[model samples]
Target: MSQEVRTVEQQTPSNRESAQRMALRPVFMPPADIYETKDSIVVLTEMPGVSSEGVDISLERRVLTIRGHSASQDHSGYQRVYNEYTDGDYERVFTLSENIDRDRIEATLKDGVLQLVLPKAEAAKARKIELKSS
Candidate 1:
């Protein structure tokens, strides 16, 4: 084939221009389960059809954003008669608290699930205060 694969960056712009163009596919806000452990806050986002290489996570100021894109399978010779599964992209944003250790944050994607580990800052960690005898 002489054509090259087109990435999301080349096709879709981050900023949505409502008046100028129509969306090619639907954009979904993936469902996330957020919980806190002793040392970290974990977030599990479910984004079907998305892979580790296709996902991007960024933290700016106090906001965290997740963007994922899944390439549609090519149907060169076959024509779609009845379509059930939806082909779309995923996006979500979160506001981080002061207690989160931004520098130590980590993320991983496996089997279409995005896992984010936000470590707690030292100041916010639970530490028992020891009593001293006078």
Candidate 2:
């Protein structure tokens, strides 16, 4: 239904200086599609050149975050090269409502595509109201 985009920043005592330097890397928002079913909500994100090990999915304080890092391609034999694509990291956030079951959420990455399944909470799922004849 409705979702909001959010950015999360984590600060650690040791990595504060390094984190500031790391911010120079380009951060791209990979394209994503989100759909809802009767039981869960599915999110599909296109993160080309990103592997399963390079992806991180986390949910904290009702904020779902999807982050991926794509390594740059290596052209060993070629000398001069013109490039149209840039290798960078991806980050996207979605604010979830109480309808989502945070504890049961699942994520999978395959072929540079990340899939997230957010199951609906027990009280949020639709239920049939039977009519009782008095």
Candidate 3:
């Protein structure tokens, strides 16, 4: 599979110097899956080396954002060692719709995985109506 790295410079909001100051870009996300049911939308994301308390989730104005910082290693007594992967943080954002019930969003983290459950608004849910002949 092909991979893409989006630097802070590339995703700069508007200003120039502020973009430079935000140069510490987060690493690519491991993987994610989203599914919708009759009552709610479920989102699952894979995030290794991250604790439940370390992850942060927020929903504002129909926008959902997830940001997390992984635990760093303490290399104090090691003389010389080989490393393959670098530990870093993860951040991802998603735009929600009016159908979502912003007040009832719930999130949970377990076993290096994050799961979000977003319930749909009552008016947006599908329902059946009955009619009688007059």
Candidate 4:
């Protein structure tokens, strides 16, 4: 499928500039799926270990940004065993278009998944024109 959303600038630990500050913990770019319908665009982001309260979303000047923070679990009185999963924060940015209705956009987070609904502006929606017999 064609990808609608794109990252402003993908940053990685190794690829990051030297002047850029480092995060104590790993920061991940949460995977997101973008779908377009007749009325709106839907985005689904997967952020495991993140809760609703940990999600932060902002939009300004047609730029949409999402941040998800997750605290690593502290296993008290437990010894280090096999390790697999790591805790970290999520971040992503998308440049939106003028066709989107900014005021009507909606966002919801549930079960570590974030769903965003970007409604299209009235002028952007498809309409059928009827012809009258002359």
Candidate 5:
């Protein structure tokens, strides 16, 4: 049996323009999942070989950014015949809504995975109130 390899299309100028517009929407990059509950938003991102100290998280103008880099380990003392994963920088951004409380956002890293908890603002949170008769 024989198998064939496929190549993906390269990014062109027109595609780049479209990408810019699409970037503003809620997005998830490779190895990442985002979910929103009634109370908060959760983001789980896989960042292999990246440490808590090396990860950078920032929020600006309702846009959240995550950046990290990984370097090749010193394999001089060992030998490897097979290698597949690439060692490079990783970056992702999210367009947060006004419902999120930027001041209360928190993030944690464990075992090369990053988890972010974005709580909704008090005013933005949905609530039910009792109505009184006049």
Candidate 6:
């Protein structure tokens, strides 16, 4: 199994009149760690400020994609001060091989971390064959 990160840019309107009115949103690739076990592959990603309802995961044509959205921070009573960290959306994609069992994939999110488990197919598991002596 292999993992790849891609950045997708949205095209603006071709019309010159409409291009000036369009605004482009920034997309970030969150840091992720992948581990391979004897029977499964585990993927963990850090997505701070993202809630469970704001996450979307999908698999298409052997490509697995994860997207996360974080709500804007609320500072209603206090005036604006020095700012350093910018909150944005997260996007990532991974390519899966035939050895993975897509039907049994599982995922969990907790404390701004996302964990995904990709189980290996039954036929893909390693097995030892015994020989019989006549």
Point to the candidate with the largest lDDT: 4
Of the candidates numbered 3 and 6, which has the greater lDDT value? 6
Question: Over the full model, what C-alpha lDDT does candidate 3 score relative to the true structure?
Answer: 0.68
CA shift of 118, model 1, Å: 1.3
Error of 4 at 85 (Å): 2.5
Model 5: lDDT to the true structure: 0.64
Per-residue lDDT of model 2, residues 19-116, tens digit only:
45347656677888887777888889999999887887877777777778787667788764687877777777777664678888899888888999
Q: What TM value does model 4 have?
A: 0.78
lDDT of 6 by residue, 95-127 (tens): 665467889999999999999998878987777
Residue range with the least summed lDDT across 10 consecutive positions in model 4:
13-22
lDDT of 1 by residue, 1-134 (tens): 11121112223335664212226777677888877777787889999898778788887765677778877865899888888877777877776564568889899888889999988788877778899989
Order by lDDT, highest first: 4, 2, 6, 1, 3, 5
Ten-residue stretch with the least lDDT total in model 1? 1-10
- Which portions of model 2 show Cα errors greater than 4 Å? 1-22
- The lDDT of each candidate is 0.72, 0.74, 0.68, 0.76, 0.64, 0.73
lDDT tens digits by residue: candidate 3, 37-131:
77888888888888987788877666666766788765788754777766766666666554578788888888988999988889877777778
Q: Which ten residues in a row have the lowest lDDT in candidate 6?
A: 5-14
The alpha-carbon lDDT assigned to residue 105 of candidate 5 equals: 90
Rank by TM-score, descending?
4, 2, 1, 6, 3, 5
RMSD, each candidate, Å? 11.1, 4.4, 6.6, 4.0, 11.3, 5.8
lDDT of 5 by residue, 5-58 (tens): 122222321235335634543222436777777778787878887777767787
